[model samples]
Target chain A: MQYRISFPHMGKYYIPIKKAMEAFVGNYGEVILPPPITKRTIELGALHSPDFVCVPFKYTLGNFIEALENGANVLFQIAGDCRLGFYSEVQEQILQDLDFDFTFHMMELNGKNAKGLYEVFKAMNPELTLPKVVSTLAVVVRIVYAMDGIEKYIRQNIGFEVEKGGFERIEKQFLAEIATAETMPQAGRIFKKYLKKLKTVALNKPAKPLRVGVVGELYVLMEPFSNYFIEKELAKFGIEVERFITASYLIFSTQHNVKKILKQADGYVSYEIGADGTDSVAKSVVMAKKGYDGIIHLKPFGCTPEVNSIPMVNKISEDFEIPVLYFSFDAQTSETGVKTRLEAFYDMLEMKKRGRAL
Target chain B: MKAYLGVDIGSISTKGVIIDGDNRIIANEYLWTEGNPIAAVKGVVESLQKQIAPEVQVMAVGTTGSARKLIGVVLNAQIVKNEITTHAIGTMSRVPDVRTILEIGGQDSKIILLRNGIVTDYAMNTICAAGTGSFLMSQAKRLGLAIEELGEMALQSENPTRIAARCTVFAESDLVHKAQIGHKKEDIVAGICTAVVNNYLNNVGKGKRILAPIVFQGGVSKNVGVVRAFEQILGHEIYVDEFGHLMGCLGAAVLAKNSGVEQLFDFNIQEVDFVTKGRECELCSNNCEIIYIYRNNEVLDAWGNRCERGLSA
Candidate 1:
């Protein structure tokens, strides 16, 4: 039986994730990339989700349901801290109740070790060698770093593109090209080619542009659909957006730099609150010290980690004398409400810049 | 004489104002929106047109409130701003020292914090409409009292009963239970008023520094009971403007005056047939809902699309 593997979507990281899953399935099967999230996805997600569960649960469940309906028989879920660790079990049971036939695999790490990940892949393909796994993962890591590098540049410049849709058009092409790479050098070459191509895109950015930083819950921060494409919305106001958290940054840098990040927060946060909550406080301090015009915090409704960090974030805002806009996204959040707040924020920032704030 | 035109079309009411270069109100009119902002704005514009002097020409137009975008297009507005900014500007213009502005409208409520003539921060109620004008109106109807009479009755109550107003459903059931349990009508009415005020302060006004010179505006400000409740709870005098309901339009007019952009504002929009239509673009999986405004079969503007495909569609 050939494996038709699928996973949930999280922003543009789908490219690297799909490549990684393909490497794992290799010749034995094919990876099924879930369709891009839409309004319908949210509706379907909310329909099956338990009332008041963080929205990411519903979104991922909806993604699994869609994947199952699309002939995928295998689903992969990565275990996470907070409420996310229990997602796989509950989602599996929900799917079973819905009478879908599929196998669910939940990958959990063992205290700063990736042996759990290796075991999961080895179980799926008993003949999988350690050398093969290491080489394949090396390429996947490069793809993630490459995608993140391109995205950071795009975030800061997408709002000021001389030709509308130019950045998105190239970014799409870049993702498609890099997804086919099988070696580290090949991945590096693809990243270089796209970076050069992206640099050539004409920009109408001002010498001193309004800058904003976004720090929040992981799922909402990474998934544009989940957060209503807030970064893109900020760009429309011609504000340079700087987001420090990416899949690559979270996996590689955050683990090693926790101490440094906490110190940068300047006693605002003494220790980790919960998953990614402390990082949010630290990043806000960094953004504030860098003189960012504003900061937007995005999270699913009743997100405990983010909710715990709000007081510190507020204190940072007070100390730095910078404005912070907090948005709690839910299944039924209205687009008009988001737009209204954003437009008002831009107006406030503009006025503040001109020394005539209102 | 040169003047500016501002129209604020909210969920429940429509307001229009004509202001001179000195920020003095030349002519103003207020009317019910009646679920048709276009018609309500036309009535307001027509009424203001009749009140203004014959020599006074409308130099520019501005629009605020929920339907600002729609009406801004219809009236050829030079400045279209959100209700928050407009409310701050309008309040500051009237009382330069206002530190806090508490506004409760038909379906929404917001608190604006200002410092030294600048709006420092603001927050609007999120995903809830429990403690707004509409909720009070519905409860008033259920109690077999006129909307205006409910407030008067509340002012007579010696003690206001506590009502659960975290959610509208709970508040409605709690009100009925109180009425059935031999609670005085005035006490219940006063309790409802307190509930609205408490809900607003707890939710919309949460975690913000609310200083003195607090100017309360919006339709709900017309209710003496709510005004008194605000003053009692905040332990500060709450100033209600005589033209509180007109603050939104007043701000819009002021903004248009200062925008430095002018166009001959024609009252002829009252005679123009403007139609708005919403259609879903199915070019991709996104299925974006696009709204188009039409005048004489020509599309004036289209929005709510996420991609270039909607433009082509």
Candidate 2:
């Protein structure tokens, strides 16, 4: 019997996860990607979610329900440390009470080790041999790196492209090409070819553009739908956005670099605050030192670590003579209100860029 | 003869102004929105048109405030901007070297920091609207006094009783308690004014620098009591223009003139038959509620859908 496994979406990291699932499940299991989030997804999640849980929880829960409706029988949940860990047990209870026929698989890594991940793959596909699993994992890791390499270049230059929607059009094509590649070398080739094509795109960006560094909660930073496509809005105004977190960065690199960031975040941060808090604090200081025009601290409502970091963020803003805009987003937040704040923030940054800062 | 028009259709108040090439305010009007932005905009435009001479012809129009998008579409405004930009530009045009602007409108308050005629930073009050003009007006009504008298009475207080203005409900109860304890009428009023100033500084102006020349405007700025409290707390002179409340509208008009997008603005919008209607789309689960503004049964604009497949922004 085939076990249809479904996973939650984080940015466009679904591409690599899809590749890994294809290799591991082979013909035994079907991988279901929940549809792109909308107002209905949020409303569905909110009805069942605990009133005070962060928005990411609500969004992912909504994903599970949608996938379940579409014939998904197995749910793959990544319940790491922080409030996210509690999501699995609560979500399992809710789905079971709803009388859905699904097996929930909660993947909790042993401090970012691959052994736990191997077990997860084995649990899903009992027939998978160790050597085959290792090869698939290696290829999956390379795909993550490849996706990150191209996405990073796109974010920096998309705002300045001479032709409107030129960057997105090319990236859409790249996503299509990468989806078909099976081997690690094929993925590498696709990334390099796309990288060169992106470089040739005509750009009319100035010598110095208004640059904003965004640091905050992980889920909010990674998901555009959750943040109301803020990065896209900024790009519309030709403002540079440096969001320092991606799926590859969070999963692969954060394990090694978080300790170093905590040390660098001394005086600004007291301890290892959960859910990218240390990284947010450390990244803000680095962005300030790098002469970024402004900083934006984004968080979800009732986010403990992000709330705790507010005072320090403000203090850093004062010390470094850079302005900071804080946004705590929820499902209830109006699109127009967010737009107004963004316009004002851009206006302030432009004024400062013209040497009008107080 | 050439002129520009600006309108600020806020949640509570709708303001309009007309200015010439030199940025001179030739006509201005302020009217309560009364819960309908489109109706309020038409009313304010008519009021301004009546005040101005026939020789003046509005070349371009601009809109600001909460209902800027709606009004921009209604009036065919050449420029639509947020409150921060218009407020700073409005105050700077009047006080060329002004460094700060404090605006407390009917239901909301915002602090805009400017350096050499450009906004550097700003913060808007996000919590409950306790320290707004409307709250003070309600408190004045409960005490059987006109809103204007509270400001005048506050000027006479020798020892103002302390009232917690952090929350509107708490501040109202505290005022009632102070009155029961035999606190002087003027002192209680003065205390309420002080509470508003304290709340404004604590929440909106928390981390930012408050510098001069500071121009205090908005509907609340008309209250002398709040002005005096700001002066006492900051220990600096506060400048209030006669038309301080109309600064946003004025800024819009000025920006419209400078926009260089010349569109013949017909100020006689009262004669136009315009209305907006909304309906939900059922093509997807999103159920996007699309709104269309119709002028003489013709679609002017439509927005609020998520994807290009439907009628969306």
Candidate 3:
């Protein structure tokens, strides 16, 4: 029985996910990747989901439905620290109630380290040996770190590429090559080759391109469509982007940096926020110190941690002398509304860079 | 003699302005969008064309507001900008000392902070239309009063009743309940005014500094009741320009003048035919819905594909 497993999409994180699955299954199984989130995806998810739940829930539920339709029997729900823990229980119940035959596995329910993830892998594959799991997990971790590093470079240079779509073309090539790897060593080689190729791309970035830092809720920050392709829009204006939220950040944030965050977020927040609130607070100061022209805080509407972080983020913006634009997105947000605000933001950043005279 | 044309097309209202080389408004027109932006834009264009002097040909065109993109494409505009930038430019051109701009249109409200003729920060009401002009207008109709008279009644109140303005539905029902409780019309109107000011402060104005030397504009700025409510709540004198409702178009005209892009904009384009077609591509699971704009049987532009597979790029 070849078990077909699937995971929801979040930007380029799918690259590392495919590599990990290739390592563990090694041609013994197939992976079912969900289609991109479209209007139909949201409708299906929203129709079955309880209203007022966070936007990511609806998106992941949609992903699950689409994956099931594509002949996947196993579904993985990667929940975060906050209200995300209960998502699988509710989603599984809904999917089962709809009479779908599938095995649901919820991982990282309590933010455990590698051992917890290993347990999940072992449960998924009872024939899996401890040594095999350890080797596969180690390779996957390294792949994630490498992928994140490459993306950082991509984000910095993609905005100023001399040839339009040059960086994106190379990025698509990297994903394709990485997905075909059959072993941990092969994956590492593929990533290294891409890094070398990425460095060769020509970029005509200005001596000092206006810099913008994006900090927000975990899902909203990672997913492009969720926030209306904000990073791409900024790139259109020749602005370099800095983003700290990613799958790697979530994994590393497991041990805790709340104390450092509390110190940085002093006078604004007195305690630790469950999700990316503290991280959002800390990154603002970092962006300010790095002299970014502006910052944008994006989160799905009704997200608690992001809502709580807004006033403090505004305070930070004032103290650091950097402007911050906040966008609370929901299903109801129109594309034109988002586009106009972004253009306005770009206008402000350009004015600030040019020393502010109407 | 060169003239610049600027159009501000929104979901609720459409406004157009034509200005000469001196940035003097030669002609302007304001009309309701009425759920059809293309028709309303055509109406504004025809009106402005008729009003402007024949020798002063339109040299450039600019567009701003929610429907700016569609109208810009249709008019072959030289400049297309968002309302925020246009509003700031327009306010600064008129009120040179303006530090803040509080604008509430038919369904949306925005607060912009400017320092030294540059926008420092800004915020818009997210996912809520409470306290906007349309909200107040509907509430006025429910009270059997003309929307114009509602403001006058609000000013006559000696003691105002309280009504919730966080949500339009809640505010409307709350107004009815207040009226049922035997509250006077003036008091209820005043209460609605205060509630709008408070709602603007808490929602759109959240975490924003409401400084002095603020210019209040947009359709809602015409309401003396809301203006007075804002003055009381903000503890500062709010300045309202005579052309407050036309600022978006005014700014767009200024931007066109500054853009220095020499595009001959002919009003004769009204004789042309334009159509938009939308279709879903079923090649892949992405199922991207592509939109194509055509002019006289020629494909003008196409967009809205997720990947290169579906896109002609």
Clashes of each: 0, 0, 0
For each candidate, report its DockQ versus the true two-chain complex: 0.54, 0.49, 0.66
- Estimate, for each residue in A135-251, the C-alpha lDDT of model 1 and write its tens digit: 777888888889999999999999999888999899999999999998989999999999999999999999989999999899999998888889999999999999988888877
Q: Summing lDDT over every window of 10 consecutive residues in candidate 1 chain A, give the lowest-scoring window.
A: A108-117
Candidate 3 lDDT, A38-94, residue by residue in tens: 777777887888888888888888888998998888888876777787899999999
Instruction: Tell me the spans in candidate 1 whose CA falls farther than 4 Å from its real position.
Output: A109-114, A254-258
lDDT of 2 by residue, B172-231 (tens): 999999999999999999999999999899878888898989899998888899999999
Off by over 4 Å in 2: A109-111, A254-256, A263-267, A355-358, B137-146, B153-166, B169-189
Of all true interface contacts, what fraction is found in model 2? 0.56
TM-score list, all predictions: 0.95, 0.92, 0.95
lDDT by residue for model 1 (B1-313), tens: 9999888988888999999998788899999999999889889999999998899999998899989998998888999998888888888888988999999998999998877777777889887899999999999999999999987899999989899968889999999999999899999999999999999988988777789999998889999999999999999999999988888999999999999898777788766789989999998767888999998778999888987689787
**Candidate 2, RMSD to the unseen true structure:** 2.8
- Assign candidate 2 its CAPRI class: acceptable
Worst 10 residues of 1 chain B by lDDT: B263-272
Report the TM-score measured on chain A for model 1: 0.96
DockQ rank, highest first? 3, 1, 2
Quick one: ranking by TM-score, best first?
A: 1, 3, 2
**Reference-based lDDT, residue A40, model 1:** 76
